[model samples]
Target: MKLSVWTYEGPPHVGAMRVATAMNGLHYVLHAPQGDTYADLLFTMIERRNHRPPVTYTTFQARDLGSDTAKLFRDACQAAYERFKPQAMIVGASCTAELIQDDPGGLGAALGLPIPVIPLELPSYQRKENFGADETFLQIVRTLAKPTDRSARVSCNLIGPTALGFRHRDDITEITALLNDMGVEVNVTAPYGATPADITRLGAAHFNVLMYPETGESACRWMERTLDQPYTRTIPIGVGATKDFVEEVAALTGCIPRLDTDRLRLPWYSASVDSTYLTGKRVFIFGDGTHVATATRIAREEMGFEVVGIGCFNREMARPIRALAKDIGVEALISDDYLEVEGRISNLAPELILGTQMERHIGKRLGIPCAVISAPVHVQDFPARYSPQMGVEGANVIFDTWVHPLVMGLEEHLLHMFREDPEFNDAAGPSHHAHGAKQVSDAPDPIGAQIIWLDEAERELRKVPFFVRGKARRNTEAFAEARGDSQISVETLYEAKAHYAR
Candidate 1:
């Protein structure tokens, strides 16, 4: 039971690449295929940028497989240095490159390169996009974290910012602002414009704020041992968590906690007024372990929803989810297979689903409303709005995202009519209307959504000459048929290499 071949927030390497690039003065040389250059889309498409990604690729092909691949990797690295002249460089690989081990870090070490080179191993085989970003940031900090000015005691580091949950630029702004308000000068904020020197100052920070849990553990521990700066385990995901995060930092550095009480008030007000309007909302959750666990707590404790089922594809973070399932008295459906996840959807019989984008297809087929609360996202998730599911602001966002789609006034209107029209209720045999996927009476129902990128690509290729188009179409159909809406399992995705090798 494993999940494989799923869409992520961006190219798997993009998250880590963002961190390495954002640093004021840093560069990253990624060992990957030439096609992996698709990472630039994140900045252009999602972040809406004009610059290129700060990465270099070895880009070995089948022809070069037997030719000194390691040397090819080193040459790429040297070329990157000659072009970028980066003071610090990160040596890393992506999913495909990981399959073929070319140790760039060792080469850099032996070469005695003038600039600092940090090794990064975020193999997509065993982890998701978030893990890569988080781990990449941690490795950078670990390689450079050192105390500065023994008497300079203003110590704190901000970690986690790849633009999934609370990884938004606004979040970085809010957090850095809050930390400054607390009198704790942040030594470095991982992946949020942190350079090699800034990373080295990580040890100077007395603590690390793990904004997201998927990554940053390594640097936190390293700083703990070297700088004796204890990192806080509190992640500011929800309203209470954000306040607590602030209070904890205040307590540590002896600064007053700032509270935008207005942010807290609305959720409480909304819960009091409309939660009952939306109570017993049968729901199911699935995705990564961090989201599954915390959202379970929020749904049960705060939102008053009956969480019918829950699971995740990330085993590293699954124990907590398993415990949550037991607490909610539901058998946790833990599998990565699309078919298995789809099958599990049956037992839950939920009105709504909060999972990855794959679940969107399940919800669409099953006629259940779905909100993508976790990763494996498509381009759709990258809205122009600052949407982070971490912190008090995030709680409000969740409330809106989950509630608005389900509480269609039209459904209530239809139900009211069903209750009033006694004849209509009595003659309810087969209806012309689509069952679960309710649409407004006066509006035309929209057609199924095509995966925008794929559909557009197909259309573009079809415009080519007949011979080229024919072959392209055939290959496209073949690849689609091979994948064929195949469900993935947590194990299959997390353990891709292990399974592939075995």
Candidate 2:
């Protein structure tokens, strides 16, 4: 594999960990080397999971390569099953271990384990994390899910919503509430809080709600094809999309779509006079395909922002992302390279950025405001507050998350305009903070004689706000100097304004 300091997605095994981690009564036995154990910290630290992931690593060292590594994997699998007593287990090889070609699947199958043993044949060199999650979930469903009697009431399985997803937990809560309000029952939420038994009960649902397409699409397609259960396509992230999702569910379950938008303040706040300035603010978006597509619609339609550029790192989503980008009059950036994404962002110089945690760093380095809209996020993105990115409550969260960066930037600009003030100097700290203040020097007096302004010119300059008078004065003097005038007049001041306006 090509060496890079950072990657947008990890090897396929990490994706397998995501699926295994999201579920209950399911264990993943990974035939890996010693260093491969680092995936544990990702869940415990980044996702802030209270417990370690449900995984057992063979953790064979360099010395063990000369020995029977296959025996080590078998022992680990047996130990995992005995220790965890899971209802189901999956076995796979990490990227480095794949080179040994121990055949983890075949080796796992040889073991006469009482529980269901599903072997995963994931090509580490070819596929990425999302694909691994999708494949793993699909395998589990294929092995466990069976056709059963449908529920008396209309119900659906909430497919997707795995661990490490950005706000998946909160999104599930919001969507579940929305479905309950619509008189629909949720059969089972899979992959996150599901068990092997839940997979079997999936056939009981009348339909499926596919929340995340990247990790759940394959599994949903299988259920739809095999179990005769249809699934919803519309993801309820924004006001418009949520409405469409409601209507889609209504059609599926014969429940009337609740068009009550009275709880939504995004439309009203967006159209308010105070937010008019936010209109036409250019934005660059990059994330997973699903989030990028949904964020584009919200950015352009809901928030009145101009989408200058849009793309995703997930190649599986390239076609739809490209189609959406074409509709918006821009090329879809479908590369995993952050450097290329940085170059594109630099060329576009958007006023705002809505993307993943990687793009958050890119924005900070470029001094652009950003909001996290997708996965691969840091621990900070997993806040203690109830922040959902779907349904009515989710719409409110989106409004705050997207708008705060711009408003905070404006606040910083205002503070900088008054930086020379004794109370507002850099050393003085923010007025809202409780830090101690320090004295800061103002600009020293001019060394040489400067252009003088007439009484009318000075009065006209005062018409500009005090905070920006220095800029007006400087521009007026420069204009007078360029014209070879000895003093600045009212005409020169107005002329400078016109020159700058152009």
Candidate 3:
């Protein structure tokens, strides 16, 4: 409602669209105005789907409002059913249409189409995207899911992979392999590759694997009460969590967990000598609650990074994220305002950021390296190759995603540190062009005083890895200036490192 250049989540109806588009043989008819059709771009352009989303907009214009807009909605609905002939249809009003009180659900029912017509009473003003997706999925399940006999072998409905989600396609692939290894069959992966028929057979599954609580929790809870099916709580995104999820599923399915580690490399890689530079590196995390919590564990436990700050934009997830932040000895930020998030990142000045696309922008502006861990992402996040954020392969993808930025950041820092050195300065040009490049002179220092480094100290500094030499030089200079010493020696450098370690 408060018009902004960017938003973490779209209007609730957009969420409804996500659910409708994610499934097969399901369509959404939205009673919206002309401009409301723009939601299609989110799917077509960003997600790069081969086909347009399964949505129909009753694009009522300003002129149509004066003359019976309800009739327009009815006409649109009849046309959508005739054209798509979906097995099920979800009808709702966009924020603009909600003002006119067209009552899409009631109108949709009156038409009496052949297939089941599920009505969505989405409060566009009161709720946002994730809530809308949850409510829509829940309504569909209530209307379609039938009581049935459970499968002979233990099976689960993989709940909550939706359209426009961050890496849902690949995550499913990685997770399915993990489940198969434990001898559990996936009954169906819903709202992503499912149909109305799949929804009816949901009760056939022994249990449910609730992948994303934001969109699937409500429906899973309802099934728990109505169908006597329980769902898994842990999401398998990291090494530890994946292990926990494997054990949890094993208990539910009575299958012995394979507990395989042959494909996992993060555990040993992070502990290796090459990764020592990652230890205690300051990091800030912000995204949806699921990813924020997952990234926090990976950063602190697996990667050995210090979590300088942590937060999420989904206010519904505030309580748990707050609890997480408390356990981590930091204040939890539960807000949707990107400006406020940017300001906090500025204050924290973390060396690295793990967050959404919005925070990716913030990190760039602040000169901090970032890796996207959640949604509200752009087209680039949807890679052409496999890049999941779950299971062992996901852990591998994450390791590459998070560490590359930090390593490149170190390279940039080293570049700045040696800017005055003729051999490495801007004037040096490319290695291939070095013969034709012009030589450059060092600029005079604008600051009156400078701490000189002794020959022995400079040699000792050179012995440090080039990637970290800049940080060492700066720390030594700071230590010298703090003690009123005009020069830095080997002793000063060692003492400064020891002081910082303490």
lDDT of 1 by residue, 1-502 (tens): 1445654334346667767656656777777777787767756665555567777778778888777888888888888888888878888777777777777778766666788888876757656665677677777776776666532766677876654343356567666665766677776677666667666656656677876566566666776787788777776666667778888887876778876656554367555755576677778898877677777777776777888899987555667778878878998876666678887875445667888888877766655667887766666776767765766667777777777656653354355346436555412321322344422221111221221224345345434332122333333433433455232233222233243345
Candidate 3 segments exceeding 4 Å error:
421-502
Per-residue lDDT tens digits of candidate 3, residues 1-502? 6988889998899989999989999989999999999877999899999889898998988998789999998999999999998999999999999999988989999998999999999888988999899899999999999889999988899999999999999999988988888888999899899999899999999999999988899999999999999999998989999999999998888899886789899999997998997999889999999999999999999999999889998877899999999999998889899999998886666778899999887765555678999998999999999999999999999999999888885675566567678667543432222233321112112221487878898767765643344456666777778899988888998999999999
The total number of steric clashes, by the backbone 3 Å criterion, in model 3 comes to 0
Task: Please identify which of the two predictions, 1 or 2, would achieve the higher TM-score against the true structure.
Answer: 2
Candidate 2: tens digits of C-alpha lDDT, residues 383-428: 8889999999999999999998888766755776677787676544
lDDT of the candidates, in the order given: 0.65, 0.87, 0.86
Please, what is the TM-score per model? 0.75, 0.87, 0.87
Off by over 4 Å in 2: 422-502
Clash pairs (backbone) in predicted model 2: none
Consecutive 10-residue window with the lowest summed lDDT within model 3: 439-448
lDDT of 1: 0.65
